[model samples]
Target: MASGTSVSPNANRTRSGNTLLVWSLLVVAANLRPALTGVGPLLDRVQAELALTPAVAGLLTTLPLVAFAVVSPVVPRLAARWGPERLLGGALVVLAVGVAVRWVPAAIALFGGTVLIGAGIAVGNVLLPSLIKRDFPTRVGLLTSAYAAVMGGVAAVASGVAVPISRAVPGGWHTALGCWIVLALTAIVLWLPQLRTPRPRSEAVHTRRLPWGSALAWAVTAFMGLQSLGFYVVVTWLPQVFRDSGVTAGDAGWLLFLFQAVAVATGLVMPTMLRRARDQRAVAMLSSAVSLVGYLGLVAAPGWALLWSVVLGLGGGACLVLALAFLSLRAEDAIAAGALSAMAQSIGYLVAAAGPVAFGLLHTVSSGWQAPIMLMCVAAAGQVVVATVAGRGTVRPTRP
Candidate 1:
């Protein structure tokens, strides 16, 4: 009776601790995309208010990707030295500050805060997989889907509400964008307990280098980059695309909302699909093909925008879940997962950083959306090709 009492208390404590960690992680995931995604619905207003050209306005989206590309490679080492919990906590501070600074009445503040926001998100992006691999090795697929769905759901909400929020609030778009800081602050509070936990010995003792020489690693990196490019391009430009096609700004925002809402649904279902599949290749190819067809449809008939958004959402959501799942699934352990994630995201985001700028430039130069939509079609085709290699059952070697 005494032993049972002792064990039960300890077990209860463990269970409660784990529950807190899971909620904290989900809150962190919720913060990753809202500040950035909120910008998409308000891009036209920002452009008109600032008297900016489309190409320069594209930079508003590209800047964060650049920051992600630049900062991601160093996160594993930072997490190793500071502990992932401490580093993640610090990142939330940066994200909160960035969101606040972005609300300041200066153009420089807008761009500069975006960089900080990107840097903050980059750390969370690279470390979450490692944390999951370390803490939930048996539940990687389910947890990945869970967080990915949270990301999509919150992102969709941010897009859908930005225009409405801006109108309702005093500061217009800036306030709409800045309101996400509340979430960042909430996440900080939820994550504080993690800072008190001690780092695991393995994480403290060794740091892993990225697997730059492995073909499989490269394949994963390409897959990550291409999928990100597609997602970011849609997030950055879809509202504008709809507006140009005669949709009202309000309706366009709702359309972007619809796109991400579908993505959230797809992300939630991905784990079941992944569980039944032999490997991820077929799923990857089929999703990519669906996205291609959607992009082609957008090019062929802008009137069918709603249909294409749903199609693109299905493909984008599946691809995102797979890309994140591959980070842990292909790695041998947590350390390897951290390294591979850093490698894939650093290079991957760099590739994605070019997408919005290029798309906008094409739109500006050609005076048509077809050319840019076609460019996305090419990217989707590339995703199909890369998915074949990245989706293999082969594990990424621990070291190059």
Candidate 2:
């Protein structure tokens, strides 16, 4: 009876600890996209107030992607040294500071703080999958879906409220942009408990080098890059695209909200679909194809923006969940997951970083949205080809 009583307390503590960990992870996910997405809806105001050109305004979005690419390669080593949990808590601090710094009334602060935000998000992006693989190996799909949904849901809210928040607040766009600091601070508090956990072993710090030579690794990299490129391009410019089509700014923000909201819904359903599938190839291909159709529809008929947003959301959400899942699904173990994730995101975000700038430049050269969106169409088609190869059941061999 004493043994039974003692075991019951231990079990309860385990459950309690696990619940806190999951909530912390979800809170971290919530912080990932809101800061970036909030900027999109306010880009026009930012551009006007700062006297920035379209190409330069695009850089505001591009800077973070660049940061993600640059910082991602080093995260695995840092995670190995400090542990993912402690490092993630540090990241939230950086993110909070970045958010606060961005609110300062200087162009340099704006750009610098954005870089800091990117650095912070980059760590979380690479570590979350590895943490899931390490702690909940069997529940990767479910947890990935959960976090992705929360990420998308918060992103949608951020987009929907940016303009309204700006209008309601005295500092206008700065206030809206900086308001996300609260979320970052909250994440930091929630994540404090995780710091008490043990660090990873020294051997993990020297785990096999990144899967640079693996064909499957490159395919996964391409999949991650292309989907990220598509998503960022839309988030950065979709409001402008809608405004150019004669939509009001507030409504444009809501449309962006709708796009992400649909994505959140789709992400929520992905786990069930993943469970029933033999391999993810068909799902990947179908999602890419749907996004292709959405992009093409925008080009052919900008008037039907509402329908296209829904379609893009459906495809984009699925693609995001799948790309993240691949970080875990393709790796053989948690350490391998971190290596593969670093490899994929390092090269992938470098590719994605160019998207917003290129889209803005294309729009400048063509004098319309067609050429810019067609570029996305090409990317989506490329995704279809790569997703086929990336979605196979083959796990990435660690030594390669």
| lDDT against the true structure, each candidate | 0.89, 0.91
True-vs-predicted CA distance for residue 369, candidate 1, Å: 0.4
Per-prediction TM-score: 0.95, 0.95
After TM-score superposition, what is the CA distance of residue 286 in candidate 1 from its true location, in Å?
A: 0.6
Over all chains combined, what TM-score does candidate 1 have?
Answer: 0.95
How does residue 23 of candidate 2 score in lDDT?
Answer: 94
Error of 2 at 18 (Å): 0.3
- Give lDDT tens digits, candidate 2, residues 361-395: 99999999999999999999999999988997545
lDDT of 2 at 105: 77
Q: At residue 326, what lDDT does model 2 achieve? A: 96
Where does the lowest 10-residue lDDT sum fall in candidate 2? Answer: 1-10
Residue by residue across 218-265, what tens digits does model 1's lDDT show? 899999999999999999999999999999999999999999999999
